[model samples]
Target: MPAEWEPHEGTWLSWPRREGISFPGRYDAVPALWRAMVTTLATGEHVYVNVGDEAQEAEVRAVLFGHEAVARTALDASAATSLATTVRGDRVSLHDRVSLHRIPTDEPWCRDHGPTFLVRDGELTLIDWRYNAWGGKYPPYDRDDAVPSRIAELLGVRAFHPGIVLEGGAIDVNGRGTVLTTESCLLNPNRNPSLGRAEIEAYLREYLNAPHVVWLGAGIAGDDTDGHVDDLTRFVAPRTVVTAVEADPADVNYGPLRENLHRLRAAHDQDGRSLEVVELPMPGAVEWEGQRLPASYANFYVGNEAVLVPTFAHDNDAVALDVLRRCFPGRRAVGIDATALVWGLGAFHCATQQQPLAVHT
Candidate 1:
């Protein structure tokens, strides 16, 4: 698997269904967020979206083309600026860069259900890991589980089934042989009870082409995915990881994040070099309807020319953007307000999956 920052032929997203469980009562507010995400990403690389049916595809077309009026409830003023260049007349015409496929999914969290693109012998291969909807927390995930194979068939590529349950969001790779994940999600009896740590590691090494595995402890507070590492840490470089840290000792996330920080500082890359750990501040606690949602700056998505960092309108939004800008100096770091999107317990990274640029050998 290639690092997210690597050149990508495109990005994939499963459009949120109005009846999907992710956004619940806020489903009306999610499409605008997806539009903003797609528009920003299409400016850099091709964006492929999956819709459940022809009707859903038509709905997505309207949303992207301005045939329908999007309620800008989720995006803040900055998103307006980000959407400016991509717009034409009343429509955001990314006709050349955006394509919608009739790949149905039960939910819109594609990173957890979408294809994990891998390059093998200079060709693109996808891994179809068994998905149990965060360990059976969500039922009727049969459709989401079949997404990888669906996409493989569509693209005419070889698909590999690890046969074990693993969400794309659970792991992050450095593209140079190192993978980062958390023990909480992978080791929890919920995900893979039949496999031990060693067995899981073996699968990751064999499938992801990552020989080094750096394991973190727990996830942040209120993350429904049993602490997905994408919400805790991400690899911004071959040997450098930008992790989220909570400054308030009283906050529930402080201890676990601190422990993860310690582990990253001690972790080494496949080349046996100590990792360069950069600390990114947490966006405090994001709540909706009296329930806390997992919101972290670490959930930013790296595109060909832009880093879409999720912001919660918090003061630290600028700080997180600055930290990431420094980390990815060559890429533009744009903060898209995720206050409404985080209600679904995810941000940019959870909804988007990268399709690495094929290197024909």
Candidate 2:
């Protein structure tokens, strides 16, 4: 098995275009948020984005460049920048720091569709986990499913096929020998009903190269993709996890989430050391069109210098940010307004995938 990938040199994101998948009347916000995210990321590292064609590329450039804040203004106001920029024909540079690609793809969730890059013995490999559009919840995912292989080919890396129904958001690694996941997502009948827990563990061991798997029970309420572990628990450090907690027993997630918390506290890591579990308060439930979206604080994506956390403009947003700040020392933990983004049922982590740098032995 290959070694786990390290932090990515940059992130890959798909520009949102499908109205049905993104939610009605909110398609405009998708591009805005995508641009904003890319701009913020470009300040630290490169950003590779996929667009449909010349037309779409033009749209992306207009959204990004048109809003490129003057360096001085950006440093002071931070709010003058628009997420999208003006199209410099087919290619546009965001302050000479970011690069955009116009690759055509059907879905925008690159974290699930993009290649899972890993390194072993100083060699780069790609783990192409089968994606089924979140258990076939969205149909016609042919383009999305093919993204991993395309990325692998583009990168000229060896692509390994893990013939199992796995989404990147379903698992979290500690960069050690331990992984954290929830049974509700990985064990669901839709994903791999024939595979027992032991069999699944074997698959994880073979692909992720992890010796230990810590199982948390379920995710918080409003998670459509069963219980994606990324929306509930994350391994902030080796042998340490930060889980979302709900204190009010009246809330729907209070019981199941608490049970998961208990399980995490009782678990141990690969070294047989008890896990240090931290609690992050769940943001007040967010409902749109009477449907609760999976607005979670656990879905923050870890970057080189910062952890991009999704905040729902709720009271708990500050507390969650603070908790993550404590958890990630030396890394800025900043919250991105996710009130509009969650309408698509995912956040920063789901929207981006890390292509870990090849490790030299």
Q: For residues 1-361, could you state the per-residue lDDT of candidate 2 as single tens digits?
A: 2222246667788888754466568886667677657766665567788787788888877877765443322111332232223223223445465656656677787877777767766677878888888788888888888888887777788889979988888888876778888888899888887998999999888887888999988777778778888889888877678898988899889998899988988999988999998998988778998988888898888877667888887789889988998988877676778777788888998888876666641
Measured against the true structure, the TM-scores of the candidates, in listed sequence, are 0.96, 0.90
Question: Given candidate 2, what's the lDDT at residue 257?
Answer: 87
Best by lDDT: 1
Candidate 1 lDDT tens digits, 61-84:
888885433334544465565556
lDDT score for residue 128 of model 2: 88
Q: Which portions of model 2 show Cα errors greater than 4 Å?
A: 1-6, 18-20, 70-96, 359-361
Best by TM-score: 1
- How displaced is residue 224 in candidate 1, in Å? 0.8
Candidate 1 off by > 4 Å: 67-79, 89-93
Residue 351's C-alpha lDDT in candidate 1? 94
